[model samples]
Target: MTNMDTLWLAPALVCYALSAVIFIAGRLTRTSRASGWAIYLLGAGVIFHALDLTARGFQAGNIPVGNFAQALSFFAWLTALASLLLIVRLQMAVIGAYSVGVVAATLGASAIMMKGGRIVLPASLQSVWLPIHVTLAILGFSMFVLASSVSLVYLAYESQLKAKRPLGPASERPPSLEKLDRINYSLLGWGFALLSLAIITGAIWADATWGHFWSWEPVESWSLTIWILYAALLEARLTVGWRGRRAAALTIVVFLVLVGSFVGVSLIDPGKHGGWFG
Candidate 1:
C-alpha cells in the first residue's frame, strides 16, 4: 500500500515539469496551442496530485495532514488547484510558469520528506476545524503566490515599457502594466479575505479545544502580521488607487515576510504549527 501510494506522486511531478516547459515554450513562440497544452498537462498533474493525497488519506484513515509531507503536499495541491481555476480566466500564460514552478517545488519537497517516513497523524489534530483552517490557509497562500508572481511580471513589464524596448519578441508575453496591476489588486483582496477567515477559524478552533484562544504563539503572531501587511496594501490600492513599482515591490516584500513567518520561523523556532511546514 505504501509503495502504491507513493507511486501516485511520480506522474504528478513529471507533468508539472512538463507543463511549465510547455507554458514557457508557448510564451516564447506566441502559440496558443502551447498554453492549451500546458493547461492540459497541469490538469493531469493536479489529478495525480489529488490521487496521491487521496491514497495517503486512505492509508492514514484521515486527512493525511499529520506531518510535513502530507501537509506540504496538500498545500502544493491547493496552489496548483488555484492556478487551474485562475489561468483560463486570466489567460495569463506567463503566470502559469511561475505557478507551476512553485507547485513543482513544493511537491518535490513533499516527495523528499516522504523518503524519511510516512507521518502518523496525531489524534489530537483530528477535528472538523483541521480541514477548514488548512483549506483557508492553502487558498490564502495560493493567492499570495499568484499575486507575487504577477507583481514580478508587472515590474518587468513596466520596466520594459519604460525603457522603450522594441516589441520584437518581448511583446509575446507578460500582460500590460495596468492589467497586471488589476490582477494583483484582485488577488490581494481575495487572499486577504481568505487569510482573515483562516485566522478566525483557527482562533475558534483553539478556543473550542484548548479552552482559550489567542496564545500569541509565533505562528499566530506572524499570521496576524501578514494579515495587517496585506490589509494595508489592499486599503491603499483600493482607496488611493496606487499602482506601479512601489505597489509591486511591497507585494513581493509581503510574500517574503510570509515565507519568513511561516517557513523561516518554522525552521528556527516553531510553535505548534512549526512541524507542519516551517
Candidate 2:
C-alpha cells in the first residue's frame, strides 16, 4: 500500500512543483503563453493528487487523515482543488501561481513525514464522524488560506494604488481591489459555515467517544477563538461596510492565528486532538 501510494504521490508532487515553476517563470517573463500552460499542469497535479488520496482511502478502510502527515497531505489536496476551481472562475492564472507553491510545500512536508512509518488511527476516532469532522475542518481551513492569499494581494495592490505607483507588468497586475474584496468575503462566508459545522460535529464525536461534549482542550479552545474572530470580522464587513485594506489585513491576521492554532497547538500540546498527530 505504501509503495503504491508513493507511486501516485510522486507524480503528483512533480506536477505541482513543475506547475509552480512554470507559473512563476511566466509571471517573471511577462508571458501569457507559459502561464496558460501552467494552469493545465496544475489541473494535472490536482487529478493525480485526487487519485492518490482515493487509493489511500481504500487501502486504509477510512479517510487518510490518521496523522499529521496524512492530514497535511489532505489539506494540500483540498487547497489545490479549491484554487483550481476558483482560478478557472476568476480567469486568473496568477492567483493559482501564487497558491500552488504553498500547496506543493505542504505536500512536500507530508511526504517527509511519511517516512517515519505508517500511522494507525486511534480506536477512539474510528467513527463515522471522523470523515465528517476532518473534512469540514480541513476544507474550511483551505478556504481561509485562499481568502488570506487574495487578501495579501489586495493589500499590496491597494498600497501601490494609494501611493500612485505603477501597477507593474501585465502579469503582475492582480484582480481589481473590489473583486479581491468580494472574493475574500465570499470565501470567508463559506469557510465560516463549514467551520461551524466542523466544530459541532467534533463536539458530537467527543461526546460519543469520550462521554463529554466540550472539554476546552487547547485545540478546541483555539478553534472556538478562530470561529469567533471570523464571526466578528464578517459581522464588521456586513454591518459596518468594512472592505478594502482593513478587511484584507484582518483576514491575513486571522489566518496566521489559525495556522498557529492548527499546527503549533496540535503538535506541541497533548490534548485529545493534539496527540492525534501520531
Candidate 3:
C-alpha cells in the first residue's frame, strides 16, 4: 500500500476502535448519549475507510479485494455500514455495543494482515460482475453478522428477563425482546435476498469465465451449503412461526457455520478459492 493509503486507513482504524470503546461504555452504563455519538464516529471511520479503498483501487487498477487483507478490510467496512443501517433503522444504538466490537476486531486483523504486500486483481476476476458478486456476498454476510450479534444480545436479555434479574439498575434497560426479534427477522430477510442474488451473479460469472455454471468446487459448494442453511432458517421462521429464543439461538449457530465455511474452507481446501488468501 502507498503512504496515502496508510494515511487514510490509520484514522479509519482509530475511529473504529474508539467507537467500539464508546459503544461498550454506553451499553455498560446505559448511556444512550454515548451510543449515539459512537454512531457518528463510526460513520467518520467508514468515510475514511472508503477513501482508503478508493486509493488502493486506483493504485491497483481495480477494486482492492485482490488479497486477503484487502478482502477482510472491505468486509469490515461493509459490516460497519450494515451495523449503522440496522441501528439507525431500529433506533437501537445499543446494538453497536456488540456490532462495533466485531468491526474493530476485523479491521484490526486486516491491518495486521496487510504486511503480505500488494496483489493485483487476477485477469479471470476482472469482469464487470466481480464487484457486483463480491459486494452482494459480503453485504449479505455483514447482515448475518449483525443478525448473529443481535441474537446474542437477545438471548442474554431474554435470559435475564426469565431469571427475573435486575438489568443494570432501573434507568438502564436493554431493548425489548420483540424489538430484537424484529431486527433479527428483518436482517435475515434482507440478507437472504442479497445472498441469493450473489449466488446467481457468481454462477453467471463462473459460466463466463470457466465455461460452466457449477464447478462443485469447495468454495462453490460451501457457498451453496451456507445459502441453503440460511434459506431453510428463513423458511422455517416464515412457515413455522419461529421466533424469540429458538430463532435467536439458531441464528447464532448458522453464522458460526458460515464463518467456518467462508474462512476455514477457503484456507484448507485446495480448490478454486483456496489460494485466494495467499
Model 2 scores a C-alpha lDDT of 0.85
Q: What are the lDDT scores of the predictions, listed in order?
A: 0.82, 0.85, 0.85
What C-alpha lDDT, on a 0 to 100 scale, does residue 15 get in candidate 3?
Answer: 96
Which rank order by lDDT, best down to worst? 3, 2, 1
TM-scores of all candidate predictions against the true structure: 0.91, 0.93, 0.93
Q: Model 3 over residues 1-278: C-alpha lDDT tens digits?
A: 45866888999999999999999997777677677679999999999999998988876677778777788899999999888887787777877988899999999988988854456777777778878988998889899999998998899889988999856655656678998999899998888899999999989988998999898988788889988998899889989988999999999999999998778775677476543465
> Tens-digit lDDT track for model 2 on 41-107?
8889899999988877876578988777888899999999998888888966666656787898999
Winner by lDDT between candidate 2 and candidate 1: 2
Over 38-144, each residue of candidate 1 has an lDDT whose tens digit, in order, gives 89989999999898888777766677676767787888898898888878777777788788888888888888877444555566667899889988988899999
lDDT of 1: 0.82
Candidate with maximal TM-score? 3
Give the poorly placed runs of model 3, Cα more than 4 Å off.
116-118, 166-173
